[model samples]
Every structure is written in structure tokens, then in C-alpha cells.
Target chain A: MIRRPGDAQFTAFVQDAWRPLYRSAYLLLGEHGAAEDLAQAALTKTYAAWGRVREPDAAYGYARTVLLNEARSLFRRTSWRRELPSDDLPEQTHEPDPSDRPAVLDALRLLPPRQRAVIVLRFYEDLDVERTADTLGCSPGTVKSQTSAALSKLRRLLGDAVLPEGALHD
Target chain B: MTERLSALLHDEALDVPVPAAPAEAIIAGGRRTRVRRRLGAGAVSAAAAAAVAAVCLMPSDGSGLRLAPDPAAASPLDPAGWAVSAGSTLYLGNGATAQLPDKVKSIYYTSAGTVVRTGTVAYTDAPDSAYALVGDDGRVHSLGLALGDRAPSTDPRLPYLAYAQRRGNTGHDAWDVVLRDVRSGDVAVSVPVDGSFTWGGWNAPPVALDGDHVYVGLDDATLDVDWRTGAVSTASHLPAARFPESTSGRVALENRSGQPVRVAEVSTGASVAELSPGGGPGEGPAAVSISPDGRFALLVPWRTCDDDNACVYDQPASEVLQLDGGRSATVDLGDQVGWTPDGRLIRVTGQGVDLCSPVTAVCDPTGIRLGEGPVKVGGNSYES
Candidate 1:
């Protein structure tokens, strides 16, 4: 073992980061099972690098970076790409058609994995462009371009009627 | 549309269920990755081992085979130097050599021993090809071909051959995984595998079996079949769809998504070296092969126009590194690099076929120089 972070501290980190991290993973990969694996893997990396992290408080951020790296690496693999969930929504019991999942979800699915990751980090996680770029290991300009491309593609797929000028903002 | 998209994603993400975090499993797995990596590097007595790092490399006796600064040779396929096998015949230079083992198609090298894959006509088209384990001591054991259209995977750590044999093609094609104990000539375990008969495509199930677990990769999921208990379970951390290669079930090469390949050696449990593709372009390795001793790595850097968007992987350079923190140096050379049963590396450079120190990357050029510009390395070159 390279770095031995205390068990209590590691457990505490997992307990706190589990939900949010897993949620981020799910948003990144769009699959529950994969999201869990990604979160677990990210946490594992965080634990391994715990001793190397200069700032103890920044461990969560370090873990998130690892998670993003794993997700991006996974994007390069065809087999992992196959693990993408269908644009299908959860089954509704007493509701309308399950096929009624929004066209935008399908558009998000159609977007490249990194672009989708950018969208999830930007909108879902509500992280700033800089933070998103940092997470993705890309320049802010690249992040903006990715965001512009992703939003343009999403808008094309969903149409202007569904998106107002400032509706995507916080 | 952006607002709607965000709202839909927000709603759908909430709908995505997060399974209970297996805290123990996560912790255990993390430790496993760490432990496996440590194990791969071999146990370090810390302060003491660091002291012994020096004086590790001395001039060698060449272990019955040594190449000098530059050895001369004529043909790359010249069998006069080392034994080469063609079909059922072995060659000693251009002349007919001793007959190869029965049903022998080609010979390959593993960290443990020489692996001879056998079948008749055009190299074993009889459903699957079997292997003959020729021990370093020169004892030969022939393991009959399995049922499927693929050969068995030998466990580098043990003398076991794991293969999936055909059982039925009716309904869903059924296959059974067989683990043969090569020395005893005994079937260690024969367990039936789930899923239809595979036609052997990209999505075909991977048959990586050993004494412990038989990894059965199906389209929907990948499974670990316990050969001993016959218990099948979902492989954790491992993508159920892709069956990664494991050296000891502890450390494995996860044929990951991106180009920088990953080796899942338990560094602490879940932490293995996830090689990041850094450096400008071809400077990063396009392909990486780890030595069985876990001491060295053969890194084939991404080459030529491969860095550009058009990408041509015509790079013919492979480097040997002492990745395990030993006194090994990075030996760089032309393409076609492999390992001998013993840990020596074999490289077919334009100069000649050379034996290299895995750690020092220094090549002791064998006299077997290649005159044929650049010829493909045959399976026989695996032996030193």
C-alpha cells in the first residue's frame, strides 16, 4: 500500500462522497450500474492517492477528477461505450408512455461522451465552465466550444420552442 | 431547448437508481488493487531493499544464450541460429530440421514456458486449437483442443490451461469451460458456461479460466465461474461485458477504453496503474505489454502520423523499461518484441535479433542478424 489514509477518514469520505459522486457518475455515463462502478473506481483512486494529496480538504475534488478521468478513458473503449443505457426512461406504472422520454435526452445520448460529460457537469452539477474544464483536463476555450457545440446540437434536436434564451442558466 | 434538456436530464438522472454502495466491497477492492500491485512489484522490505537497488546489474554469463555488441546474421528466418518450426517440420537454417511435435502448428512463448498451439491443416481449424506445454526442462504435454473455435489461455503463474469446450449447439449453443492440469494430465475442473454457442466475433465470450475462476464474458454480462465451487458470480469493478486478462486473478490487464492501457494490479485494492497518454503524440505508448514477473514493460510508443487526426500506427519502435523500480533501463529498438520463457526480452531490430536486459534495456545483440531488411518474427523466436 503506497499511502495509508486512516480507515475512519476513508470511511467518512466514502459515506459523504458516495451519493454525490455516484450521481455524477450516473449523469456522466447514463447507466446506474456503470455509475456505481465509476464511483467505486474513483474512490479507490482517491484512496490510493490520499497520501499524495497536498491539501487534505481537496480530497473530494481529487476524487472527482479521478472519476472524470475514468469516464473519459471509458469513452475511448467501444465495449464500455456499449454500456450506454438506452435513451429509454424509467417505466411508469400509473402514468403515460415510458417512450415519452424527452427528445433532448436522446440528443444528450447522441452527443459524444465528453460533450455529454460537459453538459452534465455544467447543468446538472451546476459547475462553472472553468471547473468543468478543470475536471475534463481541457482548456476553458475548449470547454466553451464543447458547451457551444453541445448546446447547439441539443437545441437542434429539441428545437427553440423548448429552450428559452436564459432557461439553461442557474 | 437547453432548458428542456437540462430539466429532462435532471429528472432522468433522479430516476437512475444508485445501488447501495458496498462499502466493504469498495474498501476491499481498493486494497486488492493496491495489494496486487505491491505483489506484482514483489514485496519490498522498504529501507533494506532500497539499499540493495544498486549492484543489481552485473555482467551476465548469458544463460547459455548471449548476444554481443553486434552479432552478424543473413536471413531473419534463418533457422541455423535458433530452432524454427514450420507446420509439422522444424528448420535448421534453410534445411529440414528435426520434425516438430505432433499436430504442432506454431510455437509461442509465455513467461512460464513454451506454448505450442496444435491443430492440423492451416494451423488447427478443427473447431479449436489445443496447446502443448513444453516445459523449460524439455517435458512436453499435449492438451487437446477445446470445443470452441479458440485456443485455451494458459495461466502464467500455474501449469493450468483453461479453455471452453463445446457442449451443444441446439437452442442456445452451450459450452463448458475445462481447466486441465498439464502435469498430471487431469481435468481440474469442467464447468458448463451459460450463453448461446458463440460464433467467435468481437462480442464472443472471453474464455479466461484458471484454477480459481473461469471468466465467462457474455454479451449482456461477464461472469467469473469458480472452477472449484462451480459458483458463478458477477465480476466487480470489471465490466461484465469485457473479460479482461488476469495474470493471477489478482493483477489484470483491463483492455480499457482509451489508448493508455490499464493494468489492474491491486496497488491498495482498487488502485492500479492507469497509464495516462501524455507527452506530445507518438511519445506515449500505443501498446504496452507487461512482463510476467511484473518487473518490465514493453512500450510501443504511438508513432509517425499516428499522432495526427489521420493516425498511422506504422511506428516500429518498442522500449523495455524496468517499471518495477529496479535498476532496469529503458532499452529502445525496432519493432517485434517478445519474452523468452525465462525473463529475457527478444527484439528483432534491423541490426539483428538481440537479447536485452529487461531492466537495463541494454541489448546484447545475438549473432543472428537479419539480412532481409525487415522480416516478420516467427513464433520460434520466443525461445532464447
Candidate 2:
């Protein structure tokens, strides 16, 4: 059973969750600085609502929900412009060869925000269907359907050379 | 099968050096929230403060708001560090050394757009209006609340810095481009293009301005304009057989013949060199992007799979092509790699499906993956 989060509890919550939250924002926004702003905005909103939240254990989930929602909302309000200037490439001492990565990213960007969110939470976070559905505010069946559709599109855009062994089986 | 795909994607993660200010940023952001609340309370009357507080405290209906953990109580913005997550959240240092502006009014989409800022540094003031520039044909367009009476154009690229003006209408489809002060919205210069550029349409051209030259990349070719003199010149004529799509700073050209072809930068009809694609064009050009330094080109080759019409059931195979001066390398990304803006690291989507099971065959119907890194599946070297 989760208790109501008090001011002290809320402070502790922010301290523990800030790093992961920040990372999530960066992954979604793709810009370090912008990601920081988005994360902060989400955090501020969470702080304001701490008193009303029912399940304190679910606070992280609630905050994550807020962050994802904020990201999607920002995307919607901004009209989904795909191009952005690169301030600096993520610093890599050793440059790996570029393969199908660019194409994959491009295809991912083409997806609608909901579908994209589902994909990110499912794969990157490695969440199961139930958790993914819960996070996305959709049914597990919808998650299954979305995963199917997204993968099918990726396979079609990329070719067999990129496919892993037994990728198209079943 | 899922394991293999996971391994491949795991290999593609770019080992980015963590920024030095993650802890500081979290702490600082937390402190700022507290200070802002106090200041907000003091700045407004009791009634106003209560109203603002009520609005902030209201339970989110979960319509537009997604929930996440709070950071204010837990961490202060640490200097010398930054943090990124798969969930699209990022944290930066909040130390005095951190150079984040006091108030960031707006962020432009690309290098072409300008992020407008307002208010005095170190002191809160009224909200500042920011504008983003979009260019089409040969004229520039401004978007945001600041442009009172002016309309936006269809051009994809806008100058980083520009002046705007409203001139006499050229025709039903024609309009004049005027230079205006960004701060005051007063026109300082004006230029006219041949056609009327409409908004909310597909196949729009991307425009970029460098010094006096305005570069436009259209569906067919790239155009250059002397904004000062109102002269337009064709820099490169794209082959009609190839349909070009421009986004961000990169352009994608697909050949209808299905034969692998390369598009190289040409000067005055002279061929400079062909951009390499790791190996020979295997399945034609799937997608192409030029690096910011103009030294490298990134290519994703087209692939064929069993679930052609269906969604991705298992790991989709795609080839990543790296093109540098004379050498080309192909890195097998058992999956797709998303490119960052600078074109250095490719963000790989980690989600995979178990193709052996009919139930989980197509794991990602949304066709979206979240992760960032560089190409690592096949042995290929990237020039830093």
C-alpha cells in the first residue's frame, strides 16, 4: 500500500528519479538542452500535483506519464517539424560505421506520436505489454496491434540485410 | 530470434561520453522550482497567487498529461554532468557555471529557424515573443505570435537571422519578401519571388540562407538566390528520374529505375565526386543524409522481408552505408538506426519481436523504437 507523498517524500522522489527522467527526456527530444527544459517542466508539474496523487508508490509512474504526455503535447503544438539543427554530436571517441541506423531513425520519426511512444516504452524500457499499455493509456491488445504494425513498417522500409536470423518467422 | 535482434541493437548503442553536470542540473532545477514558487507568490496578489496555485494543483485528467516522477525534491541540478533517458527526458547541470539562458522564449526547428528570447538576464520580466523563419521559393516566412499581420510561407528553411517586410501583392499566387527587424517587426527590406508559396501543403521546398545567398532545395533541384540583389541561380539540377525529399538539413532522392545511383555535389556542372555508400548501391537509395561538415554522407539501403504488407514481426534487416572521401563501408544494422542532427551517432531502436510465436510475431505495430547510439552491428569504422 502506498501512502500519500509528503513534501519530504516528494523531495526524495525527485532526487532519485531525476537522472532516469532526464535520460528519457533526452531520448525523446534528441537535444540535450531541450530535453532538460522538458524534464524540468514535467518535474514542476509533478511537484504541484503531489498533494492530490492517490498512490505514492505510483508517483514515478505518474511522473513518467506526465513527462511522456508533455513530450507528446509539445510535439503536437510544434506541428511535428522533423528537422533540427545539431548543436553537437554526442561525443564519440571511436566512430562506428553507419549502416541502416539513419534509415531506421527516419522511419521511426514517420510514426504517429502515440505509436512512437508505445514503441519506445516497450523496447527501450523493455516493459511488458501490460505495463506498456498502462503507460500509453491503451489496452494490451492495442499494444500488440501497434507493435505489429510498427515492426511490419520497419521491415518493409529496411531490407533483408538488416533483418536478424529468424526475424520473419512464425 | 528476439535475442539476436536485441544483441544487434545493443551493439548499435552509441557510447556517448556523459556530460559533467547531471547532478548539478537536477539540484538546480529543484531549487529553481522552490524559488519560482515563492517569487510567483510574492509577485502576485494573494487572490492571484491562489488562482495560479489552484491551476497548478488541479488533478490532471490524463487527457494531455502523462505522469512521471518528480525531480525537485530528489536531486539538484549538478554541474559537470548531463543525463538522457529512453523516455525522452533529459537533465542538465544547474550550477552557476552552466550557461543556460535565463528565459528561453522559443526554439527553432532547424538551423534555419531562430529561437527568440525575451526578459532581462538574471531577472524575471514579461514573456518575450520569439519567431521561427521558414522560406519557400525565394522569400522568407516567419512563424510565431510576434508576426501580427504577416502570413507564413511554405519554405522549409528560414535564415538564422532575417529581416521581414510586407509589400504590394504580386499576384494571386505571388508575394513579395521584405526584410524587417526581428524585434520590432518592422520591414527593412523586401524581395519578390515568381510563384506564390502556400502553407499546409506537401512537397514544400526547404530554404537556407548563408550571407546574401538563399539556398532552396525543391522536389527537383536546388536553387540559390542573392537576397540582396534579388537574383536566382540554379546550383544543381536534380535528375528528373530521381524524386527528392528534403527534411532537416538532409535530402533523400529515390531513383525510379531501381538501379543503385549516387548523387554528388557538382560545381558549375562539374562533378566533384560521388558520395560513397559502404558497398555498391545494393537496393537503391532508401534514405540519405549529408553530415554537417560536408565530409560524410549517411545512407540506409532498402530491404525486403517476409512481412512486406504486415507489421514488423521480428527484427527487420537494413544496411547502413557510410560514405567518406574515397572509402565506403556497410554496417549491418539488424534493425534501423535513427540519426542525430549532427549525423555522428545513430540512435538505434531496441524493441524486437519473437517471429517464432504467432502471438508476438509482430511486436511493434507502432513501428517506433526508442534508443540512441552509433552503428555497431557489422564491423565498420566512422571518422570522427
Candidate 3:
């Protein structure tokens, strides 16, 4: 486990976590420019309030919380739309697996802010309900309900698509 | 199918790109913020120092630096030789892009008959269009169109406006909104609504038109209509007991019942999960506006200090509440009301006219003026 991060410690911490943090922001924001901006903003805010943080090991979690809040704030400040290229690209050029369905992301984008956050933390981050609730600053019951509601909506929107067998358990 | 969907979501999640230069950008932003804070501190210190010097330099006879008072600083209400409204008068500048001056207020043609302005400008941009009302002079104007293209047709009533028409004869003809070329009498674009299935009654006029969408207020339903396709979607709706007053897709609805108003996005229809301004009942919502970009929702809450009700009618204390996603901030406008075209600053009226730039929530009483009529501070007066 990492020790508590001070101002000096933050520089190293940021350097280490920057990549994954950026990836998480990109997924939440959809636009590369905004994702970059959001990630940097979260990190900067974390640095500014570092002295107030009680636990050094929890800095990463605190930064993630800031990122989530910022992502939600950005969504509110603008009508965010992910630019989906309409052209059919060759399989080799596609970043994700060619067989991966894009409709799921589309449906996910349609969900409201809170539900979207819950899903991102629960599924993508592989966090348990209590942990997800802790990160979101909400009760575990709220997290459970939001996750259930979001999954139900996703199911309705995606129709025949279902979660992979071990995906939820993870 | 659920498994497939989850897999796809996971794949997309993994493919999201990381930003390359985050630290540099944050550092730059921090530098700028630090500079601004220092500048503000300097200004405050300078003012304090000046006040002390004034006291120290005063002669026993009481005459100190009494040369001719600078005329520029004497009259606080003097106009700064610039147009003083919430929006800008020019298109290329940093403020709200100016709308064409000669055109009528807020009249427009779409699938839903002619849309008229209610005289309020929203703070956020609509998801689809730039909605405005035709002015009282009966001239039709749009925000981004060139003056030559905006000339009203000879028919007057049936101006050659641009609109999106419905294809074939779908029973959902009600959803067919269009953008008309008022001068040429030609249909510019016809958008087809593919799968939208719900329709809320019209509450207000369509305010702005973007390339494919028309921003309209259907009775209590605030929505965006695809001008090319007749796709209809709800953006926000009016709270109960609140009838809409002047509106740009963002509206000012009055809660006559003195109850706190709650609005929700139509997609989550009739669910508490989607409701906003979830305050206790009885706290009425004052006139409110949304930014043109649909990013921020501004709520003005009014406090009537008198039981006569007449006192509360015109001089209620007004507070502006800006809601951005889960975060919210309260801005004190004193008297200013309307927002600029870009939604960056609000035009406020009070002791002297001023602009409250929301990015900072600071009021600059530099170059603003109050016009005639019951001067609504944040309301839009551009529409006919």
C-alpha cells in the first residue's frame, strides 16, 4: 500500500497514476480534449486540497472522486456527444475488438449522470457496492438501487445483449 | 444479449484514450489562477492604501486634492458609449454573438406552425437550434443568418421562413418541424423523425434553430425537434402550477401557487429520479432561464417581504441559482437579470446597470442601462 502523499509525494503519485486516470476520464467524457482537461483538473484539485486529506493511501480514491465529480459537472456544462466515425474502417485500424458492439456505449451514453457514474465505477473499475458508494459519497443502498436501475435500463435499451458470465462477479 | 452488451461497453471503456499533457495544462491553469488571485489582492491593498493616504493628507482646513472631480467617475449611471445588454452587438467578439438588429423579434417557421418569442433569453444553448422570437415590428430575424437571407417575405403573415418537413404521411405529422428560407419561399431542409414516440403539449414557442434541431416549448413540454428528421425529444419541462412566461427553449415559468417548482428531463418522464430543484413544497421558483448550450439551468428564487402581496409583486428580493450537473452555486445579482448570447455573463439592473460574469460571479457595473417597462433584470427583450 502507498503511504500518505504530501506535496512532494504528489508529483510522483501523479506521474504513476496519470495514464490510468486519463483513461478513466476519457471513458467518462468520450471526447479526448475534454477527457484530458477533466483528468488534469481532477489532479490539480487533488493537489490543492492534499493537506486536508486524512489518509495518504486514499489519495488515489480521492482523486477518482474528484474526477467523477468533474466529469458530471462537465456533462452538465455542455451537451456532450461522443464523435462516432460513420465510415466503415478496416478491422486492423479499429482500437477495440472488431466484434465488440458499439450499441452498448450508445445506450450507456443515454443514461442520466448518476446512473452513468454508478455503472462506470461498478463495472469498469470492478468496485464492490460498498466501495462504489464510498467513492460516490452516497449510501450503499443508493449505490445498489442506482446500479440496479441503470442495469435494467441498459437491458431494455440493448434488448438481446447480456453481461458476460464472469463479468458481473468480477 | 445482455452479455454481449456488457462486453461491448467494456471494450469501449478500455479503448478510451488517455490525455497526454495533463500536468502541463494543470500547471498553466494554476499559474493563471494564482496570477488572478494576486492581482485581486493587489487591487484590494491599493484601495486600502489610497483610503489611508486620503485620511493622512487631509489638511486641518479640510481641502485635499479637490481639483475638478473627474467627470468620468462622477456619474455612475453614465453609459460607457457601448451597447449595454446581456448579449454582444457583434458576432466575432468574446461575449454572446449579436443577433441581427433589423429583424423582427422571435418569429420562426417549423413543423409546428409559426413560433413566437416570449421575450426571455435562456442562459444555455439548446441541444439543437438557436430559438428567438420575431420582434413586435413584425420583422423575422435569426441569430446566425446573414441580413440579406433574413429579409421577411411579402406575405408578412406567412413569412418565407426555413423549416423541416415530414416525409410521406406519418401519423406523427405533428412532429414535423422545418426551417424555412423566409425570402426565397423555399424549404431549406427536411429532417425525418425515425423512432421518437412521445409528444408533450406545446408550452412555449420554438426559440432557436440549429442545423438539424428546432428548440421549442410545447405548452409545458420544453423540447428539441430535429429539423431534418421529425425526431422529437424532451429537454426539460415546466414544474406544476408554473405557467411559462417569456421563454427561449429556456423559459421563465411562474409558480402562482407559491410552491417550489421541480423540473425534469423528459426522457426520464414522471420519475423522481429525474426531478430537479427537489426542494420542499411551497418555495416558489422565480423566473428562470437555461443557457443556450443546455449546460446550465439558472433558477431565480424570489422572497416577498410584505404581506400586502402588492409589495411582493414588483420588488421581491431575487437570487440567481446556477445548477451545473451535481454542483450548484448561488449568485447575487442585486438587480441584473438577462444573460449574454454566449451564456458567459448576465445583464443585471439595480443601482447602476452591470454585468455578472457567471464564470466568476462578479458584477461589473461598467456599461449597462435599464430600458423602459417593468425592467426584468435577466429576461430577454430581443424578441418581437
**Candidate 2 residue runs with Cα over 4 Å from true position:** A1-170, B1-173, B176-190, B196-212, B217-222, B239-260, B269-282, B303-324, B332-343, B350-384
| Residue B302 error, candidate 2, Å | 3.9
Question: lDDT by residue for model 1 over B284-354, one digit each (tens)?
Answer: 45555655445555554432211111222233334454544533345555555655433556666554667
What is the C-alpha lDDT profile of model 2 across A1-170, one tens digit per residue? 42334556666777776666766665554446656666665666566556546776877877776676555334422123222211222334554354634454454455544455555666555668876654443345556756665565545544444554345432
Q: Using lDDT as the measure, what is the rank order of every candidate, best first?
A: 1, 3, 2
Question: Residues B225-306, candidate 2, lDDT per residue (tens digit)?
Answer: 4555565555453321112222222233222222223434432322222323222111123334443323344444332222
Query: After best superposition, candidate 1 residue B1: deviation in angstroms?
Result: 40
lDDT of 3 by residue, B185-248 (tens): 3444433333222111111132345333344433234345543335455444432111122222
Q: To one decimal, what is the Cα RMSD in angstroms of model 3 from the true structure?
A: 22.2
TM-score of chain A taken by itself, candidate 3:
0.53
Q: Please give the CA lDDT of all the candidate structures.
A: 0.51, 0.36, 0.40
User: Residue-wise lDDT of candidate 3 within A30-121, one digit each (tens)?
Assistant: 44654665677677656655665578688788887767655533332211211111222233443444245446666666665456667777
